[model samples]
Target: MYTPAAFRQDDLGELHRQILACRLATVVSQGPSGLQASHLPLLLEPGEGQFGTLYGHFARTNPQWRDLAEGAEALVIFQGPEAYISPSWYPAKAEHGKVVPTWNYIAVHAQGRAEVFEDGKRLLQLVSRLSDHHEAGRAQPWAVNEAPREYLDAMLRAIVGFALPIEHLQGKWKLGQNRSAADQAGVRAGLAASLDPRDRELAARISADHSAEAAP
Candidate 1:
């Protein structure tokens, strides 16, 4: 999250958008045993707080939830597209041979107090919402109600629900903003020609950022 002013993303809506795009977040906490982290698909409840609130579940066997003290502070990191930029992609490399390889990526860090709970009603609501959100994109969407009630109930019994009221959020979009315009354009072109779809995505993000900046 070491972001220069040029690369800092302070827009709340944009931060939420990125978090939604990267649904799986890494939640980190500290306890007597030291730091522990869990990867979970968190759902953001926008407008639930000044920054927003995060909802997710943890497996009953996951020790991270048990070690996490009630109302303890946690950091949820959402990572977006990333790609490696070769020095050869920069025009400056040809001009002065001064450019070195770098990485271009976008990330959001959300800090908040986490509350773990085991209310079955709330857990059902959380599961239904999560299922709907993810299934909406599929041609043949699935639902929690599609399964047998007893089976779903048993499955739900094996998990714990948690909520995090976001106190602060930070975003960093490192898309070659430090480089010259020509160098950035070179990077975009190089990325566009690459075989990796992620590289092309980073290229599009870079171009989009530049476009927004250039807009009146």
Candidate 2:
């Protein structure tokens, strides 16, 4: 991620919050065939290391898991709120017509050593945890043990679990951070009035950043 100082997001807690909110990550790895990427919902273990550890499972039929090695490098990308910024939202555009359209978004990149495992017990635990996390908000939450024992066992056997202990993490948040305060306010106002949910979310994030900057 190419992040300017003004747009860099280095707060570990904030990064974790975004990652959890995003839920899904793009896991990328390199192998003899070529670079492969898989989209998976991952759980982050904050206390696993200096950065953290990522846990997720892959379908047994997914060949992307075959690229994982004990100590091989892996990249996981977590994307948060993103929106298009129109030049009309910039105050400078009216001042001197120097503004151009751009994009505003947040993303976190986690690099780590990949480790793949296939223990049935571990797979069961992984599936249980993943289900718990995603189903918590449902009125009738589902559980791994909700199905028949033989069926659950067969389902678990069709997947493989993996862990990536994070070695490096980088975050980029381009929410009009490089623009003047007036311009940022203008962008926020424009985004707030838009009908797109993503634009409203980007506006809220920008407002939060402003509040954080204003804090003593």
Name the candidate that leads on lDDT: 2
TM agreement with the true structure for every prediction: 0.93, 0.94
Clashes (N, CA, C under 3 Å) per candidate: 0, 0
- Please give me the total number of clashing residue pairs in predicted model 2: 0
Instruction: Kindly report which residue stretches of model 2 are placed more than 4 angstroms away from their true locations once superposed.
Output: 208-216
Question: With candidate 2 superimposed using the best TM-score fit, by how many Å does residue 99's alpha carbon deviate from the native?
Answer: 0.5
Error of 1 at 29 (Å): 0.9
lDDT of 1: 0.87
Q: Write the per-residue lDDT of candidate 2 for residues 64-130, one digit (tens) a residue.
A: 7887853457899999999999999877888889888999999999998778999999988998999
How good is model 2 by TM-score? 0.94
Residues 37-121 of candidate 1: C-alpha lDDT, one tens digit per residue:
9999989999898999999999998877876545557889999999999999877777789778889899999998778888888
Score candidate 2 by lDDT. 0.87
